[model samples]
Target chain A: AQTVTQSQPEMSVQEAETVTLSCTYDTSESDYYLFWYKQPPSRQMILVIRQEAYKQQNATENRFSVNFQKAAKSFSLKISDSQLGDAAMYFCAYIPNFGNEKLTFGTGTRLTIIP
Target chain B: DVKVTQSSRYLVKRTGEKVFLECVQDMDHENMFWYRQDPGLGLRLIYFSYDVKMKEKGDIPEGYSVSREKKERFSLILESASTNQTSMYLCASSLVTGGWYNEQFFGPGTRLTVL
Candidate 1:
């Protein structure tokens, strides 16, 4: 079974600054997908960024980027130019290339945007 | 835009009560998932359906059953609710293209409390 770990339970970043949330996973599969999801208070959860294990380049989406280290089995999310909208619970997820594509999520990190 | 809606935003039930949580998705997605979120545990998949009338148990399917008579709707049922079942329930949908899974869109979670 694959397991994702997010050690930080809470993180805070000042407005317009940058914050990084750490994540690591245990997986024997060489090919898989990793994802970061954000869930705001009483709002829908949305995808932040995704990284493919086979792709060496990290994935970037707007102000959100991921540091995917396949060799170290680490995948961290970096939020730049942080805004108030970034305050939410961030989750790291893993899914293999095969099977039912069920996601295994880490214990979330609650991000607070300090203004 | 893809939209997944749950039947209730909040629910309170008594122990031994039969509870049903309904989820409906738009955009004709082929896969729908049910998950429970806790404080220290991110999201644990309870069940998922790939097609109409076809359902699969996820990582944490114990004490839960699912029904998917239609492609757009999936229902999670707790035959006898317990205090341990109190948690936030989330519904998500994703597309399967060429045997690969796409990004999942989530609904505003339902917070259920069992007394």
Candidate 2:
């Protein structure tokens, strides 16, 4: 069984600033995929970024980026130039290379963007 | 754009009532999932289907059943709704051509309150 943990239950960042949400997981597999998802007030979950465990290069999507440390079992999401739209419940999720690709998600971090 | 839609955005039911939640995907995805989200608990998968008429139990499947008779639609059923089951239910779809590594498209969640 695998599990993801988000130690920070809440995080706040001023508009145009930067913030990072921490995540860590327990997995014995060497190859897998990691993802960061955002759930807004609309209750729609959107993919923020993704990283392949084999790829050392971090994944960046516009203002959203991820620092994936496979050895440390850590995958953190970074938001730069944060905007009001970034305010949401951010979740760190992943699926191993086996099974039905069931996603294991962290407890989630509530991000608040202050103007 | 990949679109996933849930039949209801909010539902209120009584204990011991039978509940059905419908989900439809327009992206022709081969994999569909049902998850329940609770505050500070993240999302816990209840069931998933990789093909029509085929389903697998996820982390939590107690008192729940699913149907995937058609490729574009998946349904979750709570045989006997309970107050403990009051939570947000989400539906997601993803392509499984090679594997389940693709990003999942989520629907606007159905918030079910069992009174």
Two-chain DockQ for each candidate model: 0.62, 0.62
Model 1 lDDT per residue over B14-51, tens place: 99999999999989999999999999988989998889
Q: Which ten residues in a row have the lowest lDDT in candidate 1 chain B?
A: B95-104
Model 1 misplaced regions, further than 4 Å? B97-100
* Pairs that clash in candidate 1: none
Candidate 1 per-residue C-alpha lDDT over A43-85 given as tens digits, one digit per residue, 9 for 90 to 100: 9999888888889999999999999999999999999999999
TM-score of chain A of each: 0.98, 0.96
Inter-residue clash pairs, candidate 2: none
Q: B1-115 in candidate 2: lDDT tens per residue?
A: 9999999999999999999999999989999999999999999999999999999998899999999999999999999999999999999999882243568889999999999
Worst 10 residues of 1 chain A by lDDT: A95-104
Computed on C-alpha atoms, the DockQ of candidate 2 is 0.62
Per-residue lDDT, model 2, residue A82, is 94
lDDT (0 to 1) per candidate: 0.92, 0.92
* CAPRI tier for the interface of model 2: medium
